[model samples]
Target: MDSMGKYIRGYVRIRLESPAPERFFSLCVHNRIPLRNLTQEGSCYEMELSARDFLRLGRFRRKTNARIHILRKNGLPFFLHRAQKRKAFFLGILLGLVLLAICSFRIWDIQIAGNRYYTTPVLLETLSEWEISCGMAKRNVDCQKLMQKIRQTFPGIVWVSARLEGTCLIIDIKENDEIPQETPVKEDTRSCWDLTAPWDGTVVSIITRAGMPLVKPGDLCKKGDILVSGAVAILDNDSQIQRYEYVRSDADIVIETRFPYYDEFSRTITVKSYPGEQKTYPFFTLFGTDISWYHTPKNTSEIYRTERQLTLTPSFYLPVTVGEIITIPYEKKSYCYTPEEALELSQKHLQNFLKNLVSENAVILSRYIQIKLTANRCRSQGYITIQIPGSDKSAVTPKEFPDLSAETTE
Candidate 1:
């Protein structure tokens, strides 16, 4: 049949004291020692010899005490031959692993450019949340899903791109343009109240850009108060005609706001006990799509959640991620209340409230012993003034009100 189980070809290695390995090989052949595979090793003769012929050779060298042993035997030469042939395969596998490692390290150093609104760190963090992270296989990542996630995370990034260059991932983004402001003209006398205050507050100081101010500093007025008027009925030297020009005013006002603080909490704890029970299943489907060759689950009073991913091939399936599960069980846990425990809980809640309120950049202007905690609710309000610089340009169009003509037809 094949090269396996052919003949019992025994190999012998001997050191001839008098002659060289070639001379010894000739002598062995002449003596009809049935030498088959022969070779030289330094001053020794390595050859394949049968048991009977080996005994005869040993008899000739009995006085000299020659060294000899079987190096190869008749059975199967497949293991050694196949092992020799697999060198390239093993080398390829090693190179593949090394390349993968290098790619993994290089992929982490992602750089982003053309990003005006979004920072690199912010985009990378968002990508990480969607599982499109470094070290993850490029084939497994979805480009469309990543783009959608980016838009969802930062709507300001109008357009962006995610691509790999050699090993680094790059993101490009563009931002939207800002809107321009508009101001009204104060040359029209009828437009006095038209140039009204933006909000209700006491007038601090006014800077008239092109028109005279009606309200001075320290003047308290409502929201609709007019600071600058556009109406100008001034007479011209040549003709007693009135002229109008645009005007702007900058004023600061005070306003009021309110904020509230409340706490509503619920908590529960339990101790669980387990009863050891187990069973094995020949096969099971994971992720509702993968078939597990074999699996077993232990019975315990625990709420367990398990997830796995498998790669299916034509003949067999391999596990991508297996044996990652956690159990959170409910138990008969009891809470004993003591004076110290109650005080601790109350103090902790108070501390949490203080920390939360102080962390909100809120300034506690004043607080009174509001005993009138009207079963309705406890409320807090604030009043502050902000200055809004008015625009110095006109917003009205140059086109005057068009005249309508009527035609009488017979």
Candidate 2:
């Protein structure tokens, strides 16, 4: 619009008080000078005129004996003049615009989704190998090439989609299962098997489902002894053995096993004395350079310090970060544990050991222990008895029992 053009060049509102106001107005119109919002205020005339048009008013004012005074000013020229006066502010605005342009054209973040078999770091490493990394120019990246590279590198990744979104490289992936699923094999279809004892243990209970029980409850079974047999003798109507049949041995056999435990630790202990106060220091980073007010002390052992970093995004962290460090001062002290204290500590350790065994499906039945505490060492020795279900199966085919061909009366 013409109004916009007038504002861009700058405009001013002026008042006219002249002996021949009609002659001044006629000269402006005849000269093709634009005047806007012309109004009469008693003995004076007011109007808006372009800054350039106002320049031509000097000659008209002299000829007509009129006085011109500016009442108000607006437009782009006035703004530029003000900006020029504050050099640092104007420079900062220019730098901000340049940074925005650079960031928009460069990649600052990368996102990957729908991946299970392949880890994020692994994919990123592959991208780095192909010259695709953060801060690269957007135009330098070939999305189709990247997709092909990913698919070739990992056969498990069946499909890949790569694209650019803003300053981030977004990758969507569809991965095939690392291990193929197969039909479940039936237990009875396996060759004849016999459940054997892996170590010496007393049988607490035995429940046979598909085999003959070789050992009963409260019987001692040594290592390599068959607890359940896969061979069963078939009988005729007269209760005489006719032939032998073999089956897949299966049973739930509980055994009570003894495990010796011995643990030792230093009696000397560490203690901490705190001042009950803390100090915090804040810091800021700009363009990878950090500006902080924190100072490190010579005796860092007496100080416990930690820091929390502030990030712009949850996944993609920028270099420009603001954070604070908190430090607490404390003193360390060492002392030896008493006999009673050592006993209590050793008891706690035993309970933890039992918990670990329980986590592995072993039931803690009972334990017997003795504690020995000295000036520099604490020792606990004991034997733990636990109940564990036996699962070890060994083949006991007909070849192993060729001598048992003699038939017996059932």
Q: TM-score per candidate, in order?
A: 0.36, 0.67
lDDT of 2 by residue, 158-184 (tens): 999998877778999998866788876
Which candidate number has the best lDDT? 2
Q: Supply every candidate's count of residue pairs whose N, Cα or C atoms clash at under 3 angstroms.
A: 12, 0
For model 2, name the residue pairs that clash: none
Estimate the overall C-alpha local distance difference test score of candidate 2.
Answer: 0.82
User: Model-by-model lDDT, in order?
Assistant: 0.49, 0.82
Model 1 segments beyond 4 Å from truth? Answer: 1-67, 70-195, 198-200, 230-241, 248-410
Worst 10 residues of 2 by lDDT: 303-312
Q: Which residues of candidate 2, in runs, are more than 4 Å off? A: 1-74, 87-92, 174-179, 182-193, 230-248, 269-335, 338-341, 360-363, 395-410
Alpha-carbon error at 164 in model 2, in Å?
A: 1.5
Predicted structure 2, TM vs. truth:
0.67
